[model samples]
Target: MLPGEFVAFIAALMAVNALGVDLMLPALADIGRQLGVTTANHRQWIITAYMLGFGAGQLVYGPLADRFGRRPILLVTLLGFVAASIFAASSQTFAALLGARVLQGLMSASTRVLAVAIVRDQFSGRQMARTLSVAQMIFFLVPIMAPTLGQLLLVTLGPWRYIFYALACFAAFVLAWSFIRLGETLPVERRRALSLHTLAHAYRLTLTNRFSLGYAVAASMTFGGIIAFVSSAQQIFVDEFGAGDRFTYLFAACAFSMGIASFANSRLVERLGTRLISQAAVLALIALSVAHIAVILSGVETLWSYMAFQALSMTCIGLCGSNFGAMAMEPVGQIAGTASSIQGFITSVGAVIVGSLIGQSYNGTTLPLAIGYLGIGLAVLTVVLVVEQGKLFHARQAA
Candidate 1:
């Protein structure tokens, strides 16, 4: 594959995960109503369960990918994802749907882990960060478009299950594309043996490295804020702000800002360095969160104001995400698969728990969400400080 194709393929792989979540947003209310769910907050479990499974599943895929190879493991998982999506579409009960979603998420975990591992196989430091940012910029389009697609489907197809079917078809297309075009990134000599001892050593190396673990934790905290917003976005936009059908467009606007920020980061990361850019972004996030909360408290929050603040916050998140992940993986290049798995597990599971708490705390107001963002920003900053030993904005030469 050409450089552009590789980057786009990577983005397409990651976009599968984004589509699974975002495409369901418009159908959340319909699913709840049809499934006899009355509580608004409980509908969040549709997303939380998949994320939990996605996180837990990562622990195994990394080790397996390290032992076998990226290509085989990814192909198998994509097939599983297709089957799981079909199962979800066929669900007759809410529990059955959740079960299928967990299965789907478990299969989807391979995509997230292996995408990072594949990139890590080729790049490091600032280059890796730039590559990831570019890929993420493209991946952001799914979130920007998915809700609108979901709404369109609901308007035309008249059933929530069709979204699952659509997901299955998309995954199948990706699976075919991957099989025909994607090659194994991990070389034979670089592959680890499939042994308990090897797995333990790899995991220990990942965890024992303070830089890797700290950045992973910090990234997880940042992800929690994102998930919190996504899980509650429908309610906040449609129910609280009365945006109605415009919710999808509003959500897309925030996603577009993140996409633009990601593109900017990709272009600037090599010159400015990951540490400087990510640190400044985190600080900006904290300040934005504080101001957003103040506006909420002042009783002056409007849909437009909320959208503007969220767009800015999402931009900060976009800048922080790729850089943080690149830094975490920088120190664990040899164990990229395992390291990616560990970090992916931490980020996904932690985000789900944190996001779920904030989503469940919805009281027909934006205060809880704003407070959650503030807490997340502070927590991320604290973790980064400990990891860097109170250092900030330190530049490193490209590896």
Candidate 2:
């Protein structure tokens, strides 16, 4: 693949995960009703279940990808994802659907882990960060349109299950494309031995690196806020603000704002450096979260008012997330696959646990999410500060 095609392909691969989540947002209520979900908050288990499985599966894929090769592992996982999606679509109960979704998430983990591994196989430092930002900029389109597309599919197809059917079809198409176009990025000479010692050593190397481990934790905390919003977005928009059918469009606008921020980060990271851009974004997020909470507490918040702050907050996350991931991987390039998997596992699993708590705390208002954002922002900043040794906004001289 050419450079542009490579970026688009990676973006598409990562977008599959986004599609799995965002596409379900519009259909959540329908699924709940059909599956006899008893409580309003309990419906969030659909997302939490998948995320938990997604995170747990990452623990193995990195080692397997290192041992086998990116291409074969990805193909197998994609096939599994397709099968699981089909099963999910035919679910007879809430428990059945949740189980299928978890299976699907387990399968989907390979796409995320290998995508990063493949990129790290080529680039490092700010260049890798730049590439990821660009990929994410394109990838944001999935979130921008997914909910709307889900709403459309739900309306026309008249069944929430059709959403999973559509996902399976899309996964199949991507699988074919990847098989045809993506060659093994990790060559034999660079491949790690398939041994427990090798895997354990890689994990130790990754975990022992302060930069890698610290930023991974920081990124997970920051991501917790985003996931919190995602889990509760439909409720906040439809139930609290009465946006109703317009919910997807408003959701898209928030996603679009993140896309814009990602595009800007792509341009600015190389020039301004990831450290500077990310730190600025995090501080901005803290301020935005505080203001957002005040607005909600005053009982004067409107839909647009909530959206504007949410979009700004998501933009901050976009800036911080790419930077944090790249920085975490910077010192662990030799063990890229295992390192990627470990970091991914921590971030995804941690985010899911925390995000779920925040989601379940929802009470017909934005207070939980807003406060969650503030708490997460503070936590992320503290982690970043410790990682940087109290340095703030200082770019590396070469970067």
Candidate 3:
């Protein structure tokens, strides 16, 4: 990464993005109540709506970054995101809120996919992974503090709308800072032509890369599974466990445990390599999910106990994220922007499938959650195994 000063800028940029996702958790319940989210399952759209906007717009950003350069593209999207957040905060109905959230998601996706492209534009392979890991570690602090911060806003201001107002101010700060320091990574000579032919070429290259697709699909499945929980967490904890006002702190604690794993993985990934760490972590998550399912079956399940394994499962997710992302970005260094677009599309497709499972089924039991996690875990394990060696346990030996 850069020195502390520039690194903090990147981290702050990333922190603003993190705030977009994690801050909503504290207010999820209140949002449900205020908007007549009458069913436990209905509330998931609060998060789902955002992801729908966020992931779908990434396809546009890839071309934008490649053609226009990253700096101007990023600033424009941040401003759009700020506008959407304002609309979201002012919405008086679920439909309006959902629309605003979708708009916010579309604009904010530039912050995400473009940021990755910026990092990739500067470096590749191990160096890129290390930089991303460092960025992620620093950015991870946002989720840890964000829920607590959101909770404060909800309690003191007596409404969730204030959180959106604050996000607008945060976005303005990031835009000003980004405008000053976020230089264009893609120079004029290096620009990819904005055309269907170029897009097709990028897609062909990305599709043909076995290593890149394997990791992308793995990361997609992993994130899909995790977001199912995120979408359902408010309902599960508040309605099922009566966590209520303390839910944000508890959620933050769980989030901290997850972020901690990424820091640990950062120390090991270079030595172990991206492929090794991700392969191993995927298996570990499968094992943990199997064990957790067994425990639930044996009737020892409760909120406290669930948190233990859940935290561990989330740790697997954290380890997989930075490593798998680096793995996907490893071979596609030539077309990082477009490759990221493809990756975002693939992952978002999985998210819609996975998020819908969590959203549509709200039985007020962990069985649904357990079944989803275990099934997805096993499915990912199978996919990775098949992709690697045509058989399980031969992942490390493949290629």
Candidate 4:
């Protein structure tokens, strides 16, 4: 495949997760009402449950992919994802829906773990970062339009379940494309045999690498903040600010800002290196979070103000996220699948807990989200300092 096509394909696989979450935003109210859910905060369980499962599920896929190779495991996972989506669409109760969502998340874990492993198999260091940045730039498009598309489907199809059915169809399409276009990247010579001992060894190698482990923790904290914002976005915009129908537009704008930042990172990472760019980006996030929290404390909440701050904060996330992943994976290439799995599990599970806390703390204000962002920013900065041995902004020589 061409480089552009390769990036787009990888991005499409990754975007499946974003689609499952973001597309549900416009339909969350509808889903809740239909299922007799009256509690505002409890509605977030729909997203959090999936994230928790997604994180836990990565533990299985990493070892499986390492042993079985990427292509076969991915195909099997996609099939499960489609089945789970169908089950979710047919749910008659909130419990059933959540169960199916968890299953879907479990199956979707392969997309993230394997996609990163595939990229790592082909590229490393700054080039891997650049490829991921470009893929992320494309991946942002799904979030940019998913809300509007969900709203459109709900309006035209006359039910919220169709949103899930649509997701299944999209997964089916991607699965077909994978069958036709994607080949196994992990060769037989490099593949590990399936055994508990082998799995334990790979996990040990991944976890003991101070550089990778520290970044994994840092990335999880940063991801937690973003997930917190995502969980509360609909409430913040529609219920608090009264954006209503315009909520999709505002969400799209924030997503667009991230895409722009990813494009900028792709252009700059090779010359400036991942360490410098990511350090600068994390610091920028800290400053933006502080400013946002001050605005919240001043009692002057408005849609424009919220959007301005959030867009900049998300841009900072885009600038650092892929770079951090690249750096973490650089030293653990021999166990890329397990390393990516561990990384995904940490970030997803951490995000679920932190995000649920912040999301549930919504008291008709944006203070929780602001505080979550700032707290995570500071936490990630500290983690990065330790990872780099108390240094900041210096690029390491690539191995």
Predicted candidate 2 versus true structure: per-residue lDDT over 1-399, tens digit per residue? 999999999999998899998898999999998888879888888888999889999999999988888999999999999999999999999999999989988999988899899999999988999999999999999999999999999889999999999999989988999999999999898889989899889989999998899999988888787788889998999999999999999999998988998899999998899899889999999999999999999989888899899999999999998889999999998988889999999999999977998999999988888898998989888988898899997876434
Per-residue CA lDDT of model 4 for 1-399, tens digit only, reads 778889999999999898988888988888999999999778888988888889999988988888889999999889899999999999999999999989989999888899899999999988999999999999999999999999999889989999999999999999999999998899999998889899888888888998888888887877777778778888999999999999999999998998998999999999999988888988999999898888888888688999999999999888878888888899999889988999889878987888888889999998888888888888889999888889998768861
Check candidate 4 and list the clashing pairs.
none
Q: Which of the predicted structures, 2 or 3, would earn the higher TM-score when compared with the native? A: 2
Residue-level lDDT of model 3, residues 1-399, one tens digit each, is 346655566677777667877787878767878988877677678777788887898889888788888888889889998899899999999999999988988888887788788888887776677777777878877878888898888778878999999899999999998887666778888889999999999988887887678777877778877677777777778888888877777777777766787787767766666667776777888788888888888988888877887788888888778777777877887888888978877776677678678556767767777777777677777767766666543323211
Error of 2 at 320 (Å): 0.6
Query: What lDDT would each prediction earn against the true structure?
Result: 0.91, 0.91, 0.78, 0.89
- Give the candidates in order of lDDT, highest first: 1, 2, 4, 3
Against the correct fold, how does model 3 do in TM-score?
0.94
Candidate with the larger lDDT of 2 and 4: 2
Per-prediction count of colliding residue pairs? Answer: 0, 0, 0, 0
Q: Which 10 successive residues of model 1 have the least lDDT summed?
A: 390-399
User: Candidate 1 has which clashing residue pairs, if any?
Assistant: none
Model 3 alpha-carbon drift over 4 Å, by segment: 390-399
Determine the backbone clash count of candidate 1. Answer: 0
lDDT of 4: 0.89
